[model samples]
Target chain A: MVVASRKAAYHHKDGEMTETLVKKNMSASRTSAVPNYRGQQVELGRETVGNVRCANPFMVAENVNVFYGDNHAIKDVTLEIGKKEVIALIGPSGCGKSTFLRCLNRMNDSIESARVTGNISLDGGDIYDKTLDPVVLRARVGMVFQKPNPFPKSIYDNVAYGPRIHGLAGDRAELDDIVHRSLERAGLLKEVKDRLDDPGTSLSGGQQQRLCIARTIAVNPEVILMDEPCSALDPIATARIEDLMDELCEDYAIVIVTHSMQQAARVSRRVAYFHLGYLVEVDDTDKVFTNPHHKLTEDYITGRIG
Target chain B: MPNQMTSRARVEAGLSRRKRKEKIFRASGLLATAIGILFLGIFFSTLVAKGASAFVQTYLLLDVELTAETIAPGGELDLEYADFDGLVRTALRNNFPELSGRNDRRELNRLLSVGAGFQVRDLVVANPDLIGTTQEIWVPAASNVDMLMKGNIDATVDESLRNLSDRQIRWIDTLDQAGRVDLRLNKALFTNGDSREPELAGIRGAMMGSFFMLVVTIALAFPVGVAAAIYLEEFAPKNRWSDLVEVNINNLAAVPSIVFGLLGLAVFINWMGLPRSAPLVGGLVLALLTLPVIIIASRAAIKAVPPSIREAALGLGASKMQVVFHHVMPLAMPGMLTGAIIGMSRALGESAPLLMIGMIAFIVDVPGGFTDPATALPVQIYLWADSPERAFAERTSAAIIVLLAFLLLMNLAAVILRRRMERRW
Candidate 1:
C-alpha cells in the first residue's frame, strides 16, 4: 500500500515532465535529455535508498571493494540476497554490477592483479576464509558468463562436468540422472534429448546458453549468478531465459547482473541500481521502476543517463 | 553541391592510384613466390640429375670354374678360408688370355670390384653343391669401370688423366660387345653397409642409425618439452623468474646446434661414460637440439587455445590441473604434434650435433641397436661428400634425396594427423 501511494505521488508530481522528456529524447537527439535534466538540478544520492534488507536474507555482502591492480573496479557496496528470490543488478557498463556478481563466487581470483576486500558470507560462513576453498565455494555458488562458453565436449558431458568434478553422483546411472534433470530444469532436455552426444558448441546461441545453465545447475549450487546471460541472445531466446530465471527463483537465490531495465523488471523481485560502482538504490523492482528515491536511479531508469 | 562533386572527383582520382598500388604489391608477392619456386626447381633437378645414375650399377659377367681343388683345396668341401679372389683372377685371366704380363694381368684384375670375391663367396656358400661345376656369376665392376659404363667418366680423355687406363677401356669395350657387361638395379647399395669401395657401399647403416636416433629424440624431447610448456603456459605464475626462464628458452632455440653436441659430449659421453659414436649419445644430443623447438611450438599451441575454454572449465569447479588436462591439452594437441614432427625432422637432418659425439666415424655395420656405433643419414652424406672418389659424389646426392624424402614423409604425417585431430573440435 505504501509503494502504491508513493508511486501515485511520484506520477502526480513529475508525470507530465517525465513524459515530455522521454518523448523529446526519443524523437529529437539523445544529447537534449542531459540538458533538460541538468536544468532540474537533480542531486545524486551518496547513500543507498529504499529498503536494503529482505525478509529472509541468506547471502549477504558488506563493504565490498575490488581493485584490479591500481584501478578501483568495485567500490564499497552492501546488499542482501533472500533465500528464494531473484535480485537483478542493473547498471551501465563498468558500473561494478558484474564485478559484484563475480565476487560472490570468487571468480575474480583467476585474475592475477585483482584483489577483493569484503565480508561476504553464505549461510553465515565467511566465503573468503582461508580454510574454505574457492573450488568448493564455486560449486555452491555457480556462475554463467556473458558469452555462452560451453566446453568443447558433448552436450551430456558439458552438463555432467560439474557433477563429475564435485563428485555429486556416485555411479554412471546417477550421473546420467543428474545430467538429465539439470537439462530438463534448464528447458533444454526436450530439444536435445536425442542428440546428447552431439558437441555442446553445435547448439544455437540460446541453446548453448541453456546448456551452460544446465552445466552450472548440475552441481546443484544454492545460488546461481548470471552475468548478462541473455545479452547475447535474441528477444525470443531472451524471453525464454527470463522465464527460466523466474522459475529458477523458487529453488535457488539468483543474482543476475544485467544492463536491460526491462530484463531486471521482468525477472527480479528486488532490483539494485549501481552508478559508478556505488549501490545507489535497492528496492522492490516495481518501486525502483516507478518511484526510485535516488535521482541517479531515476535518471538511469527514464533514460536520461546510461 | 559543387563541393560534393569535387570530393567525389578527388576520391575517383585516388581510387586508380590505390588500385595500382594494390596491383604492384600483389605482383611483387607473386614475383617473390616465383623466385622461390624457381630456385627449388633448379635445386631438385640438379639433385635428381646427379643422384639418378647411382640407382643402376654396372656388372661384369665372368665364367668362374668353382673347382673343388681351387675353392676347397681339399677333398672335403670347406667354405671358409677359400681363395675366392684367386677364382676371380683366374676368371679374368681366362677372359683375356693375351694379357699375360704382370702389369697386364694386374690391369685386367682392376676391371672387377674388390667386392667380387665376397660376391663369389656368398654364392658358393649358398650353393655348396655347385662347388665341382663351373658357374657364370655377375659381379660388380670397379668404381672407375662403373663410372665409365654410366658415361660419367669421359673415355675420350687421355688415359693418364682418367682413373681408367686404355687397356682397361678396351677390355671393357670388348666385354660390352660380347654381351657380358650389363647394367642392373643396384640392390647392393641398399643391402650392404658402408665400404671403401663405392660400388659396394650402402646407406642401410646410416638409415638405421637415423631411425634409432629419432626414436630416442622423440621419446625424450616430446614429453619433457610438452610438460615444460604446459607448466609454463598454464600453471606458472607470471613473475620475474618465469620471465627469465622464458627468455632463456627462446635463447636456447637460437643457440648453434653444435654447442648441444659439445654439451652432450661432456655430459653424456665423458661424464656418464656412454660409448662415443652410439645412436643413444647422438639421440641425446639431438634431443637437446630439438627440445627448444618443441617447447616453443607447444607454448604457442597452448597459447592459441582460447581463454574462454579455460574459463568455462574453471567456472564448472574443475581444478586447474583438470582444466588443463581435460580441455587445454586436448585442444592444443594438434599444434603440439605438428611442432614435435617439425622438430623431429630437423633432428633427422641435423649432422653438426652428432659429429661432436663421434657419429661422424666410419660405421661399416648396420646398427642393430641404439647403443651400436652408427652414423645418421646427414653424417653419412657428409662423410661421402668428403671422399675423393667420383662415385661418392653421386652417393652423397642419393643420401641427400633420402633425407629429403624422410622429411617430406614426416611433414605429410603431421598434416594428416593435424587434420584428423582438428576435425574432433
Candidate 2:
C-alpha cells in the first residue's frame, strides 16, 4: 500500500492540531456507542486495490472514474493487473467493482449515458486514444458476461466468431485448430466434440460459460475480463468455472468481479475490495481475507456490513 | 384440518359446478371455431359448385361437302373468296331440312359460334384437300348452346327470357341424343386469354399479370423495407426526425389501398410516363401499399432480437454491422418473413388499387412481360363479375379459386422459408 504510506507521511506532518480535534470528536461520538466516522474524520487509505505489484505488468489503470449521467459510479481508483495472474474484484452489489472492471476494457463506452475518465494502458500504449479502434482494443482484451449469451449459431461458430471477425485464421484447418485449442483450454472439448454443430445454447449453464470463455480466448487476447462469470450457475457449475478460471490464468491476466468472498480467497492470488464507489482496500488474497488493512475491508470480510 | 374440510355433498356439488363451467367454456370455444369452419366450408362448396362448369366446354358436330367451288372459288386456294361462312350455313341447313325461310336459317346459324368461319378458313388454308372433300368436324358451340348442353341454363324458362330459341334448344337436345354434341374438359380455359366470347376466356393472362406484379412488388419492397427497418430500429438515433418517420410509417400502413392506386395513376402513369394497366405500374403501387406493412413487421422482428446477443457479439470484438447482419438479422428473419407473408397475401387478394391503376382492363393477350397491359387475378374477377354473361359469373368464381390458390402457395412458401431459416438461440 504505497499510497497509504505517502498519505500517512503527509497526514502525520499536518496532524498536530487535527489529531487532537479528531481524538476529542472520536470520544464524543463514542459516548453514544455508535462511532461517527464523518465527525471523527477516520483516515482513508489511498492505496491501489490488491497492493501486490508486478515488475512486468500487462495493463495499468490510473485514476479511473466513471459516471452514469448524474451518478458518480466509480471514484479515482488505480490498479495494475499483472500478466498471468488472477485478480478478483470482490464487493457487495452496486459497489463499483463491476464498473471499475468494465472501465479497464472501455466496455463502458457501449452505454450511452456512461462517462468514463481514466488512463488505461496495455503494454504502455494508451487504450483511450482516438487512433486505436475499440474493435481492436476489444480483440486484444476480451470480456465474459455473467449470463452466458451465445450467439444463435452452431457451437463451432461460437468459438470461431473472434477469429473469424479478426481474420486471425488463414484457412478452414487453421480456424478448426483455433476452435479446438480454445475449447480444449476451456475444458469443454470432450463433451462437445461430436456435437459442435448443435446450437451453442444447448450446453448446460457451466458449459455455456466455458464456451464463452473459449470464445474470448479464441482471439488470443492478452487480458480477459470476467464480470461474475459464474453468477447464473449452480454451485457445481460455479466450481467448474472457477477451476477453468484457474487454468486460464497461466496464459492471460484475468480480472474477475465476484460476490463470493470464499471464491475470491480460493481462486484469486490478490483481492481488491470496493465500497460506495471507492477502492477501500487491496492486498494479497489471504491477507485481505484474514487481516484487512482498512476498517471497511474488515467489516465486509467478516460479514459485519456489506 | 378436519374442521377446514367441507361437507362431502357440498364438495361434490362445487366440483361438479366447476366442471360444468369448464365444459360450457370449452363448448362455446368449440362452437365458435365450428361456426368459422362452417362458413368457410359453405363458401368454398358454393364456389366449387358454380365454377366447376367453367372448366368444361360443349362442341357441335358439323358435316359439309367442300369442293373447289366452296373453298377455292377461282381455282387456287383463295381464302379471301372462300365461302367458309356459307359452307357452315349450308351444313346447318342440311341438318335441319325443315328450316326453309331466311329468318329460320339465320336462327339456326346462330347455333355455331362466329369463330367457326375462322376455323373453316384455317382448315382450308392448312389443307386444300379438306375443302375438296366432305369431312365431319366438331366445332365449339356458341356460349349459350354450350351452357344449355352443360345444364347451366334453366330449360323450363320461356324462350323469350332465355338466350336461345325453343328450336335451337331442340336442335341441341337432338345433337346430344345423337351423340353429336359433347362436353369435354376445356383446356382452352387454362390456355387462352380474355375474349368477348365467354366460352373462350381464361385466367392465364390474369395469373401471369399477378405473377409479374407480385414479383415487382416483392423485389422492390422487401429489401427496401428491411433496410429501412434495420436503420430505424438498430442504427437510427433517438430524435424528433426519426420519431416522425416512424409515426409516418405506421400511418402509411393504414391508408386505403385505392389511395395507393391513385398515387400510382398520378405518379407512375402521368408523371413518369409508365403505361397504364401495365403490371409494372400496378406492382409499384402495390409495393407502396405493402412497404409500410413490411417495414413495420421487420422493425418488430429486429426488436425481438435480444440485447444480450448484441452485447455478447460486441464483447467478442464483432463490429456493430456484423452484430446486426450476422446475428440480429438471422434471428429476426422468421418473424420478418411472417410479416412479409401477411403483406403478400393481402397484395395477392387486393383489387381496389389494381382497379384504380386500370388493372381491370380486359387483357386479350397473356402478359408477356411486366410492362404489357395486364389484369391481375382479382381485377380479372372484378371485370368478370360486372359482365352480364352467365358463363362469366362462373369464370369469376373460378378466378377466385385461382387467386386463393396463389395466396395459399405464397403463404406456404413463406412458412417453409421460415422453418428452413429460423434460428433458435
Tens-digit per-residue lDDT, B33-91, candidate 1: 99999999999999999998888899989999888987787766676757898898898
Q: Which stretches of candidate 1 lie over 4 Å from their true place?
A: A1-44, A304-306, B72-77, B423-425
Where does candidate 2 chain A have its weakest 10-residue lDDT segment? A29-38
* Clash totals for all candidate models: 0, 1
lDDT accuracy of residue B274 in candidate 1: 100
Show what share of the native A-B interface contacts model 1 retains.
0.63
Worst 10 residues of 1 chain A by lDDT: A27-36
Clashing pairs in 2: A50-A282
**Candidate with maximal DockQ:** 2
Model 2 docking grade: medium
Q: Distance from true position, residue B335, model 1, in Å?
A: 1.0
